[model samples]
Target: MKDKKQLFLSFLMIVVLALMLPMSALGAPGNDAPPDPAYAKWGRIAVQEVKAKYPEDKVVDYLHVGRKTNNQETIETFKLWLEGETKEFGVIIDIHFDTDTEKITNIQFKETSR
Candidate 1:
Protein backbone atom coordinates (compact mmCIF):
# COMPACT_ATOMS: atom_id res chain seq x y z
CA MET A 1 0.00 0.00 0.00
CA LYS A 2 2.82 2.46 0.86
CA ASP A 3 4.63 1.83 -2.45
CA LYS A 4 1.41 2.26 -4.43
CA LYS A 5 0.66 5.60 -2.69
CA GLN A 6 4.25 6.85 -3.35
CA LEU A 7 4.02 5.89 -7.05
CA PHE A 8 0.65 7.68 -7.49
CA LEU A 9 1.96 10.85 -5.78
CA SER A 10 5.05 10.80 -8.03
CA PHE A 11 2.84 10.50 -11.13
CA LEU A 12 0.60 13.41 -9.97
CA MET A 13 3.71 15.57 -9.35
CA ILE A 14 5.00 14.82 -12.84
CA VAL A 15 1.63 15.72 -14.40
CA VAL A 16 1.44 19.01 -12.48
CA LEU A 17 4.99 19.97 -13.52
CA ALA A 18 4.24 19.22 -17.16
CA LEU A 19 1.14 21.41 -17.10
CA MET A 20 2.96 24.33 -15.40
CA LEU A 21 6.02 24.26 -17.70
CA PRO A 22 4.17 25.74 -20.68
CA MET A 23 2.50 28.42 -18.57
CA SER A 24 5.81 29.51 -17.11
CA ALA A 25 7.38 29.63 -20.55
CA LEU A 26 4.56 31.86 -21.79
CA GLY A 27 4.86 34.22 -18.82
CA ALA A 28 8.66 34.56 -18.99
CA PRO A 29 9.84 38.06 -19.91
CA GLY A 30 11.71 38.71 -23.20
CA ASN A 31 12.34 41.44 -25.70
CA ASP A 32 9.10 42.60 -27.32
CA ALA A 33 8.89 45.08 -30.23
CA PRO A 34 7.61 48.51 -29.27
CA PRO A 35 4.16 49.55 -30.40
CA ASP A 36 3.75 52.07 -33.24
CA PRO A 37 2.97 55.69 -32.50
CA ALA A 38 -0.62 56.81 -32.95
CA TYR A 39 -1.60 59.76 -35.13
CA ALA A 40 -2.93 62.90 -33.51
CA LYS A 41 -6.34 64.43 -34.28
CA TRP A 42 -4.90 67.05 -36.64
CA GLY A 43 -2.92 64.39 -38.43
CA ARG A 44 -6.04 62.27 -38.96
CA ILE A 45 -7.99 65.29 -40.22
CA ALA A 46 -5.16 66.13 -42.63
CA VAL A 47 -5.26 62.63 -44.06
CA GLN A 48 -9.01 62.86 -44.45
CA GLU A 49 -8.75 66.19 -46.24
CA VAL A 50 -6.10 64.79 -48.58
CA LYS A 51 -8.25 61.78 -49.37
CA ALA A 52 -11.21 64.01 -50.02
CA LYS A 53 -9.24 66.33 -52.33
CA TYR A 54 -7.72 63.37 -54.21
CA PRO A 55 -10.37 60.71 -54.15
CA GLU A 56 -8.61 58.62 -56.80
CA ASP A 57 -5.28 58.53 -54.93
CA LYS A 58 -4.12 56.56 -51.92
CA VAL A 59 -1.87 57.83 -49.17
CA VAL A 60 1.18 55.54 -48.84
CA ASP A 61 3.30 57.25 -46.21
CA TYR A 62 3.07 59.93 -43.51
CA LEU A 63 5.43 62.20 -41.59
CA HIS A 64 4.72 64.67 -38.79
CA VAL A 65 6.95 67.64 -39.67
CA GLY A 66 6.82 69.13 -36.17
CA ARG A 67 5.18 72.21 -34.69
CA LYS A 68 5.90 75.93 -34.34
CA THR A 69 4.49 78.55 -31.99
CA ASN A 70 4.12 82.29 -32.06
CA ASN A 71 2.51 84.88 -29.79
CA GLN A 72 -1.07 84.20 -30.85
CA GLU A 73 -1.03 81.03 -32.95
CA THR A 74 0.64 77.65 -33.44
CA ILE A 75 1.49 75.87 -36.67
CA GLU A 76 1.79 72.13 -37.24
CA THR A 77 3.05 70.57 -40.45
CA PHE A 78 2.73 67.08 -41.92
CA LYS A 79 4.11 65.50 -45.07
CA LEU A 80 2.24 62.73 -46.81
CA TRP A 81 3.22 60.57 -49.77
CA LEU A 82 0.46 59.60 -52.15
CA GLU A 83 0.10 57.18 -55.03
CA GLY A 84 -2.31 57.70 -57.86
CA GLU A 85 -3.18 55.68 -60.94
CA THR A 86 -0.93 57.86 -63.02
CA LYS A 87 1.72 59.15 -60.62
CA GLU A 88 3.27 59.27 -57.13
CA PHE A 89 3.83 62.51 -55.21
CA GLY A 90 4.18 64.12 -51.80
CA VAL A 91 2.19 66.85 -50.06
CA ILE A 92 3.02 69.22 -47.24
CA ILE A 93 0.06 70.24 -45.09
CA ASP A 94 0.16 73.12 -42.67
CA ILE A 95 -2.37 73.46 -39.85
CA HIS A 96 -2.54 76.77 -38.10
CA PHE A 97 -4.34 77.04 -34.78
CA ASP A 98 -4.84 79.61 -32.11
CA THR A 99 -2.39 79.31 -29.22
CA ASP A 100 -4.84 80.34 -26.50
CA THR A 101 -8.01 78.80 -27.94
CA GLU A 102 -6.46 75.76 -29.67
CA LYS A 103 -8.90 76.21 -32.54
CA ILE A 104 -7.81 75.60 -36.09
CA THR A 105 -7.55 78.86 -38.03
CA ASN A 106 -6.28 77.60 -41.34
CA ILE A 107 -5.21 74.50 -43.27
CA GLN A 108 -3.10 74.54 -46.41
CA PHE A 109 -1.40 72.03 -48.68
CA LYS A 110 1.41 72.11 -51.22
CA GLU A 111 2.31 69.29 -53.65
CA THR A 112 5.89 68.12 -54.09
CA SER A 113 7.90 65.49 -56.00
CA ARG A 114 10.45 63.02 -54.61
Candidate 2:
Protein backbone atom coordinates (compact mmCIF):
# COMPACT_ATOMS: atom_id res chain seq x y z
CA MET A 1 0.00 0.00 0.00
CA LYS A 2 2.86 2.37 0.83
CA ASP A 3 4.51 1.73 -2.53
CA LYS A 4 1.26 2.28 -4.39
CA LYS A 5 0.71 5.64 -2.65
CA GLN A 6 4.25 6.74 -3.43
CA LEU A 7 3.89 5.81 -7.11
CA PHE A 8 0.62 7.72 -7.41
CA LEU A 9 2.12 10.82 -5.82
CA SER A 10 5.10 10.65 -8.17
CA PHE A 11 2.78 10.41 -11.19
CA LEU A 12 0.79 13.39 -9.99
CA MET A 13 3.96 15.41 -9.56
CA ILE A 14 5.12 14.50 -13.05
CA VAL A 15 1.77 15.58 -14.54
CA VAL A 16 1.85 18.93 -12.76
CA LEU A 17 5.40 19.58 -13.96
CA ALA A 18 4.53 18.67 -17.55
CA LEU A 19 1.67 21.20 -17.62
CA MET A 20 3.84 23.93 -16.16
CA LEU A 21 6.60 23.33 -18.70
CA PRO A 22 4.26 24.03 -21.62
CA MET A 23 2.92 27.23 -20.03
CA SER A 24 6.43 28.53 -19.52
CA ALA A 25 7.39 27.68 -23.07
CA LEU A 26 4.39 29.64 -24.38
CA GLY A 27 5.71 32.75 -22.58
CA ALA A 28 3.91 35.24 -20.35
CA PRO A 29 0.20 36.03 -20.79
CA GLY A 30 0.93 39.76 -20.98
CA ASN A 31 2.79 39.24 -24.27
CA ASP A 32 -0.53 38.72 -26.08
CA ALA A 33 -1.07 42.42 -26.61
CA PRO A 34 -2.94 44.15 -29.42
CA PRO A 35 -1.57 44.67 -32.97
CA ASP A 36 0.29 47.64 -34.39
CA PRO A 37 -0.85 51.25 -34.19
CA ALA A 38 -2.57 53.45 -36.82
CA TYR A 39 0.76 55.01 -37.74
CA ALA A 40 2.23 51.66 -38.78
CA LYS A 41 1.23 52.29 -42.40
CA TRP A 42 3.11 55.57 -42.55
CA GLY A 43 6.03 54.03 -40.75
CA ARG A 44 6.35 51.42 -43.45
CA ILE A 45 6.24 54.12 -46.10
CA ALA A 46 8.94 56.07 -44.33
CA VAL A 47 11.21 53.05 -44.19
CA GLN A 48 10.58 52.26 -47.85
CA GLU A 49 11.29 55.81 -48.94
CA VAL A 50 14.52 55.88 -46.98
CA LYS A 51 15.55 52.55 -48.47
CA ALA A 52 14.88 53.85 -51.96
CA LYS A 53 16.78 57.05 -51.38
CA TYR A 54 19.75 55.33 -49.77
CA PRO A 55 20.10 52.07 -51.60
CA GLU A 56 23.66 51.69 -50.42
CA ASP A 57 22.64 51.84 -46.76
CA LYS A 58 20.87 49.31 -44.56
CA VAL A 59 18.04 50.41 -42.27
CA VAL A 60 19.05 49.19 -38.84
CA ASP A 61 16.36 50.77 -36.64
CA TYR A 62 13.16 52.76 -36.81
CA LEU A 63 11.16 55.05 -34.51
CA HIS A 64 7.83 56.78 -34.84
CA VAL A 65 8.39 60.30 -33.57
CA GLY A 66 4.79 61.56 -33.49
CA ARG A 67 1.96 63.04 -35.50
CA LYS A 68 0.71 66.54 -36.23
CA THR A 69 -2.45 67.84 -37.79
CA ASN A 70 -3.39 71.09 -39.42
CA ASN A 71 -6.75 72.14 -40.91
CA GLN A 72 -6.81 69.51 -43.67
CA GLU A 73 -3.47 67.70 -43.51
CA THR A 74 -1.91 65.24 -41.08
CA ILE A 75 1.80 64.53 -40.84
CA GLU A 76 3.25 61.29 -39.52
CA THR A 77 6.86 61.63 -38.54
CA PHE A 78 9.36 58.79 -38.23
CA LYS A 79 13.07 58.51 -37.58
CA LEU A 80 14.99 55.74 -39.30
CA TRP A 81 18.55 54.80 -38.47
CA LEU A 82 20.67 53.59 -41.33
CA GLU A 83 24.04 51.85 -41.45
CA GLY A 84 25.92 52.92 -44.53
CA GLU A 85 29.25 51.72 -45.83
CA THR A 86 30.80 54.89 -44.50
CA LYS A 87 28.92 55.48 -41.24
CA GLU A 88 25.59 55.35 -39.38
CA PHE A 89 23.03 58.15 -39.56
CA GLY A 90 19.41 58.98 -38.82
CA VAL A 91 16.79 60.33 -41.20
CA ILE A 92 13.63 62.05 -40.07
CA ILE A 93 10.76 61.53 -42.48
CA ASP A 94 7.50 63.43 -42.41
CA ILE A 95 4.62 61.98 -44.38
CA HIS A 96 1.92 64.53 -45.02
CA PHE A 97 -1.50 63.27 -46.02
CA ASP A 98 -5.06 64.41 -46.43
CA THR A 99 -6.79 64.01 -43.10
CA ASP A 100 -10.13 62.91 -44.55
CA THR A 101 -9.11 60.83 -47.55
CA GLU A 102 -5.75 59.63 -46.29
CA LYS A 103 -4.12 60.44 -49.62
CA ILE A 104 -0.43 61.21 -49.44
CA THR A 105 0.34 64.87 -50.09
CA ASN A 106 4.09 65.13 -49.52
CA ILE A 107 7.01 63.30 -47.95
CA GLN A 108 9.96 65.18 -46.55
CA PHE A 109 13.24 63.74 -45.29
CA LYS A 110 15.87 65.42 -43.15
CA GLU A 111 19.16 63.91 -41.93
CA THR A 112 19.93 64.46 -38.27
CA SER A 113 22.66 63.62 -35.79
CA ARG A 114 20.31 62.90 -32.90
Candidate 2 local lDDT, 1-114, one digit each (tens): 686467558767877997898677668765654578999999989999999999999886788999999999999999998867677689999999999999999999999876
For candidate 1, the TM-score is 0.65
Compute the lDDT of residue 48 as modeled in candidate 1: 91
Residue-level lDDT tens digits of model 1 in 1-114: 686467558767877897887676667578354454443877888899899888999887778998888899888899998978787799999989998887999999999996
**Cα displacement (Å) at residue 58, model 2:** 0.5
What alpha-carbon RMSD in Å does predicted model 2 have with respect to the real structure? Answer: 16.7
- Residue ranges of candidate 1 with Cα displaced over 4 Å: 1-39
True lDDT of residue 55, candidate 2: 96
lDDT of residue 110 for candidate 2: 99
lDDT for 2 in candidate 1 is: 83
Clashing pairs in 2: none
Candidate 1 least-lDDT 10 residues: 31-40
